[model samples]
Target: MRLRPPDRFGSLVTLRLLFCHGAVDFNVGVTTGGGGMTGFSTSDLALLLYQAAQDKNRWPVLVAALQETANPFDDDAIYRNPAARRELLDQLLPHISQALDMADRFESQAVSQNLLDRTLEMLPMGVALLDDELNIIMLNQQADRTLAEHEMLANHDGHFKINNREQHKLLHHYIERSLEDGSSHALMLSPGNPRSVSLLVCPADLVKDRDDNDPPAVTLFLSNPDFQSLIDEQTLTDLYRLSAAEAELTRDLIHGYDLRSIAQRRQVSELTVRTQLKSIFRKTETARQAELVSLVLSGLAPLRGRESVTAKVADDIGESTGLRYCKGAHGQRLCFAEYGDPQGVAVMFCHSVRGSRLEVPGGDSVLRDMHIRLIIPERPGYGDSEALDERTVDDLAEDMRCLADHLELPQFHLLGYSLGGFLALHCAARLGDRISRLGLVSSLAPPGKEAGKPLKGMMRLAVALADKAPGLAETVLDHMARTILKNPRRHLGSSVDRKLLAEPDHQERYLLALRESCRQGSMGFVQDLQAVARTPLPEPSSLALPVYLWHGEQDGQVPADQAIQLDRWLTNSELTLLPDGGHFFIYSRWPQILANFVAE
Candidate 1:
């Protein structure tokens, strides 16, 4: 399965060699023309193929790369034009197939990994493999669901933790014991709480069949009765052809409710409950309640919890709660979700690096009260938006102009949150008259001597990495995004103001936003960080538009001085510094921020 390089691609091989040898920085906008035949550059195809060669999920990586390069616009283009996709496949698939075949010559490692992943995903209980340092090496789909839904456990920077101090120590001890003497241990957690769960840790034997790298030392199994029923009512109705009432009844039964209890909760008679249960049984072809529940749980229903990003959002966001896509200037698909009053004043929001269209700070009610029409666009490779081969703040600002034109927004207030500030800043300088005002919330500033001075922990490492190694920075940021998505409680815990997220409603909204941030992976975020790190910071004097800057004194991600510097630099700008605000200060101060926009 050897692939001969086409004679026209003779020079591309040298480019690939240089890229592989680190002699070239692909992140520095490396482009090699393909004789003007294809929309994609030879270098882009070569790089994607190289990535696919090493990626476990090579087919999807290759296919997605092709789709991205082929049409570049129209997210649905692949499905709409099979011939186009096939043409792409013909050009690149053979090379990737050969690479994969060479890699699998000794063993079908790729197939084995897929099988192992599928097996873990199908398990009803959460499964995680951790090393002695408590760093997670592997996490299954149920593990993410369990961690997201449960309060007893959390993951920070891929390290697993228990909320209870004693339990946390005990879990660590058990992991150490398993690693030291190959022992197995089990314990119950949060005994009286509805979120209570049990954990089992066992030593894992070294696998001779695995590659040279050593695997995690301990395998942890987590499960709870409450975690068992993650499937939504809509999924049940769709799968079993049950009516809405019957679907609700089935869900209640699956959640361990008896007929009498369900009837009382539903404000219906026991007879009605039994009748609905009977109909559910008939639809599901099950005779008894236990059997019916077992049938649903043992089958595909459990996997519905890991549905696509479009299906995961709440139903009540607005008329366009789901993702709506518009074609970018380059025909790229620009995705955004609209919230608040559609007829209200338009305020285009730029989400953080790891955020999506669902990254509303204070939710829809706040926007409605302020009479602000909030439009949160998912940057390329975030949420349902298309991915760009190369991205720049200037390119992104142009895309925003396309979106504004598509939405018929003659003028709108621009707001950037966290990493999104880079885009907002560029838009302010680039879009000129189209932007009424600029608002930055806990946003990033241009890299300077004091760039990483005000940050600590992950944020600091991320900034430093972006400066020294953009590729590695993207990988690290993407991993962090996954961790935050899998366990948003960890994200909340790490924030400065825990009290705001303490309220269950506020907490749920925050968690949902965090979850959607990485819905399509964190490529958008990683790229944004690179663009910001590489792009020249705009001179304060140049951005003559009325600028509003908000920063938290206790901010852990960005320096407060940067905001103050912007305040001094901009001629007509105002600055607000919260004594207790942090990186997420926008969530709490959004009302004040929106008021400023409305006042204008």
Candidate 2:
């Protein structure tokens, strides 16, 4: 049958009709009549048509009818007759092509919008998109919040306007740079603002590809400084413990500025500045500017030889190998090093419990050059010395005496550090007439039970644990070594002269000795603690020998106040405080300490 053509047909409608007709006639359903109907009912035909449309069969006539129909289901009048349906499809082909084109355009727009929204949401920093004229197109949540908090941008006359004067200037500069130079730029918020914000400006082309019609655009990212990143100003105030005005003065003092300059800067009277300085001096316990500077710079000072008591001692023994082993009180082999003239007046150097004879700098040289004998004997369980089974403070003193007698020396001078200092004091008290002089560096007398009960208990527990479980005891000792003596580098702080400590390989050698001493000195240290615990301190009047006590004012481990107390106890004793020095004050201010000791 010849069919009439329909108008307003498109390609999509043509494809739909072709698919529907092909499915019903061939693969979809059964035909009924002899004329090749296959017994399919009207409802069956309609279901077959729907499936055919979805399957997209190539049938030109039905496809044309689908293209022409505005609504295929509503075009029943023309579709009722087979010839009319065929004619209508031809006319509908153009309209069907137009409909397909519209569908595709709509889908592409939706996808583009979705992509833009997702990209904006994924950004970490606040972002605002603006047109060439600086009109806001869109902003993320972070950007909105930042602008509101800083009041940088405000809604004015139905448009967002830059409200902050400084921020506006910054924005203009940033935009100009981004456009003229094609570069990214950033600016920090003004200090006058309560909140910290950073503005980053970049060409929008940096984010998107450039198109002919796309105007010049800029993106601004606003960021606030994290509070967690800043140190608390209050902590500085508390560390110095100064009032507001005094704190300002202290800062000037640290800068080496004169009081008059500080007053002028603060627009205050010089008298006021002087008053603050005096208050600062009292609070810091400093008497002079040098002392104050020393206190601050002690950590920066370089390690040097022990303050020269006299001159560097010559190697009178004429032997490079000065170290030797001797029998201690308990018949244990004690490591010893001799310096200077053995027949000259002997000076015995004792180290702390976890210290070794190696800690003394220039011992052999000083001993030899000064024409004075030097005996540096390792304490029990220190260096190569054997550990003592039973020990007391008096026992150590007796051992010292025995060593002095063994060398055939009638009398000797004594010097000690930390625990060794206490032992030296004890020895001086016992051998008042035999000892010539005493030097104690960063040492403290044993605290009485009334004052040291807690410490005593802790020591006792350690001793017990070590005796019961040697493995656990070793672990505890390792922890102590790591936290304390192992890294003297950390303690050196600003006081350690890097150049000097780095020279002569002394710092490395000293640290090595420290570790070795800790590993081997545990047993002797316990014995020493026991000794101090049991030995009764003699009356101050009993000590007639000259005693020199030195301590570091900044010592955190041992309080310098202990030195003051000891000075009061011993009438003939002299106390010197090292400003800004720590427990290892001797290492920091060794020159002065040694000179004073020699002069005495």
Q: Largest TM-score belongs to which candidate?
A: 1
**After superposition, candidate 1 runs with Cα above 4 Å error:** 1-232, 242-320, 447-464, 482-511, 537-542
Residue 369 in model 2: shift from native, Å? 4.0
Best by lDDT: 1
Predicted structure 1: lDDT: 0.68
Off by over 4 Å in 2: 1-319, 341-344, 449-475, 482-486, 491-506, 519-521
lDDT of 2: 0.58
TM-score of 2: 0.42
- What is the lDDT of every predicted structure here? 0.68, 0.58
Residue 581 C-alpha lDDT in model 2: 68
Candidate 2, residues 127-237, lDDT tens digits: the string is: 777765567777876566556665555545424456777767667777877887878988776656656677778888655566878777788776644322222224335
Please, what is the TM-score per model?
0.55, 0.42
